[model samples]
Target chain A: MSQGDGIYPDDLKYTKEHEWLAVHGSIGTVGITHYAQSELGDIVYVEVPAAGAPVVGGEEFGTVESVKAVSEIFAPVSGEILEVNPALAAHPETINRDPYGDGWLLKIRLAEPKEIDALMSAAEYRKYIEEEAN
Target chain B: MPPAAGPLKTTPLVRLFRDMGARLVDFAGWELPVQFSSVIEEHLAVRGAAGLFDVSHMGEIEIRGRAALELVQKVTCNDASRLGPGQAQYTVLTTESGTYVDDILVYRRGENEFLLVVNASNTDKDFAWIASWARGDVEVVNASARWAQLALQGPKAVTILQGLLGGPLDSLRPFRFLETEVNGTRSIVSRTGYTGEDGFEIYLPPQAAADLYQALLRAGGPHGLRPCGLGARDTLRLEARMLLYGNDVDETTTVLEAGLDGIVRPAKGPFIGSDSLKREKERGPARRLMGFEMIDPGVPRHGYPIRVGGEASGAVTSGTVGPSLKKSIGLAYFPARAALPGTRFAVNIRGRDALAIIVPTPFYRRPH
Candidate 1:
């Protein structure tokens, strides 16, 4: 915790693109990692798909723009939107101030259960960003 | 090292930021030092006291000849006919459809010499556009390669500049110039700036740039002329209600629609965009540019959907959490009816509704 904001938890599965997924059987809670949101700074706008909108694996799901630049948010696996973060609409900077609690972007029902095991673990994902940054 | 794709180019004070371990961002193809320092702190410096800007990258195009004034009047939005020698005016280069090519400052130096300082990226394009339309004997010259530009701006700018120039500089009115010597180096000093503060913009050769920068840094050292980057430049201009060309006004956005009707002279004879501009001025635009504040948490940025009646009307051109105002403010084009100040609307930020209100242009204005 002293080395800046720490990685979320060992149980969470993370994509190389900085998205994290918590799998409870087939239903998944998908959101950008605390690391991703911190790098992006204040989240001014989020552009996730509709609740019923079907998103494909490795496809662009939405966009998030900060004051300086705009970035595309990608889906790690094919999924359907279950619920979106309603609190983010008013307090988007919570992603920067506190990403794990209030900054979780959306919840989705996964189409592929096998994709979870393919993602890196908290320890591995933390190492990945460090390597990527280098 | 992964086959380095050429070394990055740095300006005079690039080493300062490098030593501080700053993130150098690429802006308009130039490897510029983004934040020395923090964005908000640099931003507040310009708003409160002073900020030094290395606007050397901006291009200067000189329209020279006996027909220079006439050519300028024909090509730009400002009425250059009324301007005497040694006067400057804010103007926009428009297409035949009255759409903006680029906004620039027209400086009338002599009977036949006029300088048009424009945005950096648009330098080649703007020169090509002017060269294509140029009919008279007046030769349009790209003088940017010959000079560097610097902006010394803020509330304390006058005091700092007055001392640097060896006397009072406030006598030069807005959009006016003074042929002065700094360290005995000839410089063209203007009382105009992109920031809303009362400041001076100095133009000189490359060799003289370093000395002037250092002299001002030493003279205004206590007065707070901190070296500001492109980040603060963008924030300050947006707050002052100055339009960004590519964002706020583009090839598709007309001068009238951009709310720059005051600068467009439709009756100034047969120039480009005269007919289209006249018609638009008479008919009024369907969607108009407006300034608004975010009522929700999300800051309204460019391309965010603007909702009028639960549907998309237009989009935001620029938006940010104004450090000075402590609130999210931005500009967008919407239905003329909803363009009213205090009119509330919604911006679609990530499939959610972020409340917004139409406020008057310029979320910040400096005291005249």
Candidate 2:
């Protein structure tokens, strides 16, 4: 997906806090959207929950820090963290350069598959950001 | 929630910043750009090449009369009697309780006239405080509205400024200023800056700010001069270890504890905070400001608690990722015993304790 101008893949589900989820079977890959990274300016540091940590939906799972400020990353759905992006520890700027690819924050095993339906679709997420900008 | 309702004051360069798609924020009642581009990019640009900054929000006060020096010496911690014409001194407006009223630059304009450039947020308070001290033979005038200021800073600063000046600028020493015309606009160009780099600060009439800004941008475009904002300015100054008034020092922070003892000369004799400062110097400050770098992968921010041996020791004052050094560095006040370089401490970053160690400041010193 071209992230040059705020691309939101229709195949993924998004949270109001700008986290996007790509589900593969029972595992869901999570990363911040291009808009989130752009609004953050430069990603200097990111702290994610350890693998096996329980993540509750609508709860903070981690934090994204820019040079200017710190923002909390919210969990899109209840799940168990399976993996974290180890590459982020050394090169957090990858979140700004390629937020959806190498910058994926974590992979999780969904505790409730029905929770995915609560997230917004790609079109809804686009409109949500438009309202926020206005 | 709806946006807070209030009219924001703007500098002459507001439209220019808006035109450049600068991210504007409300700072001390003034609508100013927080960043023109990205903070790191603008910060690196200033360190490698040059960056232009709109610093017109800073307040300027003029003191003129036979007693100008006396009034200045009474309120400031530095000895102004030693300054001759064209020289500037980094000083502080101290309160009677031995705390900082504001950190300012004392520019000796003439034998009986001086100018004080102070922080933006403290302008009104400073004016009132200084005016209260003015008596017979001394006149304090708030000239903030009459002037605009721009800082051109970095390694290429001199070369870029030299291109627009009619006279030789190589002779202008650091901390000294020259009153001259730049592209026909009257200005006071000073070899001073907060970025820990060689640069010049141009103070001119508000009406001439826009024109000079554009002219300098056009002249400096080929040389890689980017228009920076407060975000870059903060990171640059943090790397330089320059104290910000509200963050690093405030009405509660004394000059002695702020690690600015070099600027305080008690031997020069009686000032507003002299008595308390003298006592503090003799007895030694209980707490001292120390610079530390995070040993872990978290950013230590302002108001975060600093821990020593699992116990709270102090609180962070100013913290940021030092772009030049590419590390998380910050300033904090620790007990005298724990303020030494190499002392280990941990900062509470969002409930997680991030290990840090005290280090010698000016985290990123420019190559000479």
Candidate 3:
């Protein structure tokens, strides 16, 4: 289900740090939330782990750098990286343009299925950001 | 998060910032816009057309008395005697150890009157430091509250400002300023800016700030002037290689090491840090600030370690992907021998070493 204006999709699970997980059976596509990309003015460069790398929940897998500061991107769930987005290296601004779709950073095979249940739903994530704004 | 220690100050144009949909953040105890549209868009607008900035947050210290020049010369590293009426000079307040207290601009308002503009973050400290050296007939007043500053920068800056003034702005040479009226408000217009592009900085009364800002926006709208914020300001200055006080230089770094030798004149005779600076010049600075561009994928960031030949070398002070240059550029301190242009080093970015090469600064110079 698509959220209004496609900012946050209902099918995605979110982490407190703003990473979104789109579960597709056992494989999940992970990327930063729209809030995350908006907070980082311009995405000049992104460093992602190569395919086949192991990523654990709550561990930093890469960094998203803007012109002003660098932000660490944490893995939402423990998994093995199946593929990393090749478009990010050349056009990091894609994260700011289409954070939910083409901006997906990686596709991973879940190592902890139970971790997905603990993630926040779309409605809960919206409330989290609303409280954060206040 | 806990609230700030003291109440945050707001500029006269704070309302205007909010009206323009600006994203405001707490910068050095002041509520200022970090960006209006986007950093890259605003930055490019300054490079291609023009951009207006509210620089009222910058501190203004007024020194007035017969001994004003003497007090200024004593506290700053540059020779203030060379400044005639209506001229400005980039100078630095140095400590006894030949380290930076703050980098400032000295504007000669009159023969015995001077206005010192300092970084917003170090306003209190700089005022206190300058006041400590005030003696004789001079009086130091923190006049920041009375004045507001606006910087209109880019290629079309002159055209936009000249339209507002309805005067011959081309006659104003670099580093020169004129006391004139702009849109019925008295102003100090100077042909100076931190950005490497041609621009004008207008200093006027706080009460007249909002009106003049609105007038400029209306006039400059057709000329493609965007309202810029601190985000674009930082990137623009970085692309120009202008040093940001806390980021590029601090009390631990000397003028010589920061590559600002042009402003430090030892021949001018006794001044604060002159002796230590002379000694350092004779012995040669151990570390020097150099500009570099990343050859690898990763972007170097502040406090990132620099390694040369697998040995720890130095640390990056400022780093960014230059919007104009479209490359990752930064400034770092390196051993004197490794500070030359074309020298190669590795920046430790997130546990990985990224290759970078030293390059001559002012990374983006405007084509005349």
For DockQ, the strongest prediction is 2
lDDT order, best first, reads 2, 3, 1
> Which pairs clash in the backbone of model 1?
A46-B350, A90-B297
DockQ scores of the candidates: 0.21, 0.89, 0.78
TM per candidate, chain B: 0.94, 0.98, 0.97
What is the per-residue lDDT of model 3 for residues B36-117, given as tens digits with 9 covering 90 to 100?
A: 8799999999999999999999999999999999899998998889999999999999999889899999999999999999
Cα DockQ of the candidate 3 complex = 0.78
| Model 2 regions more than 4 Å off | A1-6, B1-5
Which run of 10 residues does model 1 chain A get worst, by summed lDDT? A1-10
Pairs of residues at least 3 apart in sequence or in different chains that clash in candidate 2:
none
| Worst 10 contiguous positions by lDDT, candidate 1 chain B | B1-10
lDDT of 1 at B285: 80
Q: Candidate 1 chain A vs. true chain A: TM-score?
A: 0.89
B1-368 in candidate 1: lDDT tens per residue?
Answer: 12125665445545555664555776766567565555566788988899888888788998988777777878887688878988999988989898988999989899889989998878888998887777767899887778888899988888887876754686788889988886568899998998888888999887778778778877787988787777778888889889998889988998888888888886677677888888888889877898999877666778888889777887889888776776788999887777688888999875778898988878898765
Q: Model 3 reaches what TM-score against the true structure?
A: 0.95
